[model samples]
Target: MTPKRVVIAGAGQGGFQVAASLRQDGFDGEVLLVGDEPGLPYQRPPLSKEYIKTGNADRLLFRNADFFEKNAIRYLDGRRLAAIHRADATVELDDGQVHGFDHLVLALGARNRRLPIAGMELEGVMQLRTLADAERIRTAIAPGLSLVVIGGGFIGLEIAATAAAAGAKVTVLEATDRLMSRVVSPAISAHFLAMHRASGVDIRLGTMARGIRDNGRGRAAAVEIEGGAVDADLVLVSAGIVPNVEIAEAAGLYVQDGIRVNDLMETSAAEISAIGDCASFPFGHDGTLIRLESVQNAIDQAKCVVQRLLGRPEPYDKVPWFWSDQAAFKLQIAGLTAGADHQVARPSDDGAKLTVHCFRHGALIGVETVNAPGDHMMARKLLALATPPTLETVEAAGYDLKAVFAAVSA
Candidate 1:
């Protein structure tokens, strides 16, 4: 029997993982990983944080070059997938090459949303998304340099923290009332706002960027807000990203917020599926269509897709988890809390450790922890368990929520 051919587009985190997981699941087929980036697959979470400050490119690599050869995964770097010929079961590359596949996975991920204000075309303004973006930001980070970050989202705040720690005057401007308002809870946002303020980051909330001013030599001189202007040598636009689903949509696939996929990650079209930031799947608890851009989501969903390809049908119902490292704090979260009604806080003895439990109609829906890994781990287990603890039980267990969970489990 001839081995099956699996062609994956967008060789980022999820794209690369899909190929690896397919082989791991005993699918001895031709795996072709295509990415527009010109190198091996690498982790993107550090691109805005550590990679921007340390310039440690080696540490960002997901796997070595030899691993691809050993696994028989053909990686085509610096090549963009212009179109998907779904009818013919082939992918059209920019170089006019058509690769046929028995199965196709669209892990096209997302692209950073660009600022529309004036002077954005200036040289000093940048966006952090790919390795090249990190390289540019890394070289621009110098002591005494004024760095103005637009957007108070995770990427912007993480970059702001790194820039501040590197001795740069970092100022974060967010149009929203709080940072990370879309994904995290109000308590978590307040905690991070306090943390950033304490770390000397000038955070300006409810502020919108009017335009950018150029010093006439094609470099950004300052960022203009509604009331006044702040002088900045470098401007980093860390706005959120939009899913890359144009090609998939052009190929007559369902596109709603992202490429719509079923529990098995299969799209509307046969022999074609989507995953990662570009794919919106059914979230278990609320049964709502959700798209997650975290590394954990990408990897776990890739595993599910691989299992399905190997004829092992299983629902992709893994608990969602995410983390963000800034300065000395590691903020970890387990499970989704999209429509939670109430939140409970549990602070540690030292006041540095904090955990916030999100409840939807008295049931534990999500958990947010800062510098508290044990509690975060327990929260994941509790979310996956048959009977989650009630709010009353959580309150009776004292501030040490992990101990309460442990005692109950024992």
Candidate 2:
């Protein structure tokens, strides 16, 4: 049966895409997007980059008030999903309001993993997840102020670079041996490590932050790490994120690392589906269930769900792509880097571009490019092909990726 009404939970990137895709897919069903945050849905990537510098909240919105009205998508902002009555096909809000739906979409995004150390509740200690969090950090940032960032992931590095550019004495503490150890290749990590360090940011690897030390006035004064304490007026914890799956878990959904969903983005329950960062679905060559926190993943999964809802069911198999801006370099990645066995680095003619080709058993698995949009675009195009360019082809072309693609086609 076609659903007459659809209720979407959470209004992050995925949640916003669900409503827009439904309209684009010719679904006339009444759409209800419920979010815990107030105001229109906004893009989160800029919260750590441009938004920090400009403080322009208006530019972050995905759609303004009129877009919702024009599309007939009802938005319930600043409300929490209290309970999900699976049998009754209804969702109750924290305000005691219950809404019935023939179909339900859970776009519940992840929350920042909290630092368990002491003095964490003190003022000036913050986490970046929402626009409000970015505003707090912006208000706290000042020239010559000590800013300590925990974790060297994309968010942490971006914040460190931005703060350093703004004249804050920034220090980053990462528990991992190298920056972005769990994601990017070692070559890429080394590049960024040097980039950040050269930009005057102190990056400490394999350093664990034991606790945050509070100043006499109840504000964070320093972060205690291994061997010594790094004095700071502000501390930003970008350690990681925990998926928001309390409501899904309570409703008896198959919850693994995240809400488990099949390729069609359907949950174990017939009417309920999950997408975006909070949902784990099978992908990759090994078909392992993994949840990705990229905007591309969220948007692609939402489109797949919309297709299924429109009676054209297809597996979600979009190739993952991601990018980050730190200091003067723009790092772009195509395909998954997990389980890659070897990598080849190619420096461009002028020395401005560098592309790292990752391979697993001689097959091109992923590509990481620095300040090279053409290479990144070509990599994405090649990854989408039925028979992608191989490592031999790349090496034969003398690392000129465009030549490799041309040779393969010719």
The residue pairs that clash in candidate 1, if any, are none
Would you estimate the TM-scores of all the predictions? 0.96, 0.98
lDDT of 2 at 93: 98
The positional error of residue 360 in candidate 1, measured at the CA in angstroms, is: 0.8
Deviating ranges (above 4 Å) for candidate 1: 1-3, 403-410
lDDT tens digits, residue span 355-394, model 1: 9899988877889999999889888888777677777777
How far does residue 41 in candidate 2 sit from its true spot (Å)?
Answer: 0.3
Query: How do the residues 1-410 of candidate 2 rate in per-residue lDDT, one tens digit apiece?
Result: 67999999999999999999999889998999999998899999999999999999999999889999999999999999889999899999999999999999999999999988998899989999999999999888999999999999999999999999999999999998999888899988998998899999999999999999988889999999878899998999998999998999999999989899999999989799999999999986678989999999999999998988999899888889999999789999999886799998877878777889999889888899999999999888888877777788888988777897888889
Model 1: how far residue 317 lies from native, Å: 1.0
Worst 10 residues of 2 by lDDT: 345-354
The models' CA-based lDDT, in order, is 0.89, 0.92
